[model samples]
Target: MSSRDTMLARIRTALANGPAPQPPQPDWAAPVHLPLPDAELAVTFAASFRRIGGEFFYCETLAQLGAELRAWLAERLPDDQQFYVWEPTLQALLAEAGVPFQATEAEFKAQAAIGLTSCEALVARTGSIVVAPATASGRRLSIYPDQHVVLARPSQVVAEIGDALRAVQSRYGTELPSMMSLTTGPSRTADIEKTLVLGAHGPRRLTLFLLEDDA
Candidate 1:
């Protein structure tokens, strides 16, 4: 009918048989790690996580993992609490484990203050999460959510920070993504009166799951 309407129709027709549009790229780095003593890597990862702004828990198998997650969530979130889940594998696992979850990219930014997921490795040198935000959804889920749960396999645990950085440069190339967050722990600040506060701008509870297979 109108010029605008005609243009819209033409565009739709042009793209009707074309591939779907790809989502915008989100900011993400490979995966980062925190430094801990060789003998105390496990305990340090669990306790000092909050110090660096993270939370920690453990699980040997997927079933155990589910139980631990449920317990941690039950303690923090209320009965009516609604959370967003990222990763298809994670979603499937949750479903298989009978864990109630909602998978919505939009919801990730709506009610989530932090996102919980696993990483390729944890640099014992620098506490960081190597995120790959090639799409906006990955970035949104981690940052938007208030509390983030990270699952780190023992094998992925590195010894130094340089190794982590090098890993990123290699994984994504020299040109880093738009966003690469190196989260050592929960977000905190002591600028005001030098008094530390958790969840100041990010997740207050930073939980970690250092999974060990041989150990």
Candidate 2:
């Protein structure tokens, strides 16, 4: 076998008995604050989510947020009962808003779940949402769940991919995590007979809660 093939063989052999490689340690630090255009931020996130076969909502108060969330979940959730998903921060927020909720990390990996969290940055140019794995938004919370609801503050939206990349590099250094998904929309693929299908390997539904603070 060629050198490249030999290396591949060795890698496969090593993996045959070893556990899956753990995701790298993300360099968790704050990004250099750069003020972006306000109207542009709203427009970017709204457009990005829509393009990905998703929906977006804006809520000024926790009450509005909870109401909107319950309404949205009502449609997508199974059966006639309210959805029971796991999100510590989200659960707290829901409770504060007097919305019935519960918490359990054990259920995070279930195929029925919908993950939620506030984001680090929303890149307008690529329509990508950048998330750090170390926060309440655990790596699994974002990837393992079937639906994802991201809460992105207007100030967190960046103008371009380079800016977001620089932000990640500056914070996480060279060895980033096992995954830093630049999720633009619902997971999709057209690999089978050029037929597009959502939720191919990720969330089939993506929703964004864009929060803007009127100063």
Each prediction's TM-score versus the true structure: 0.68, 0.70
| TM-score result, candidate 1 | 0.68
lDDT of 1 by residue, 104-142 (tens): 755444556446565645755555556557532466655
- Identify the candidate with maximal TM-score: 2
The models' CA-based lDDT, in order, is: 0.65, 0.71
Worst 10 residues of 2 by lDDT: 78-87
lDDT of 1 at 105: 53
Candidate 1 — which residues are off by over 4 angstroms?
1-53, 106-110, 135-137, 212-215
In angstroms, how far off is 158's CA in candidate 2?
A: 0.8
- What is candidate 2's lDDT per residue for 1-215, written digit by digit as tens? 89999999999998887987799997667455555565686686668668767687888887787788778877776663224435566567678766654355544344346777666678875578887775656676676667877876677777877778787787778767556678888888999999999889988888888755541
lDDT of 2: 0.71
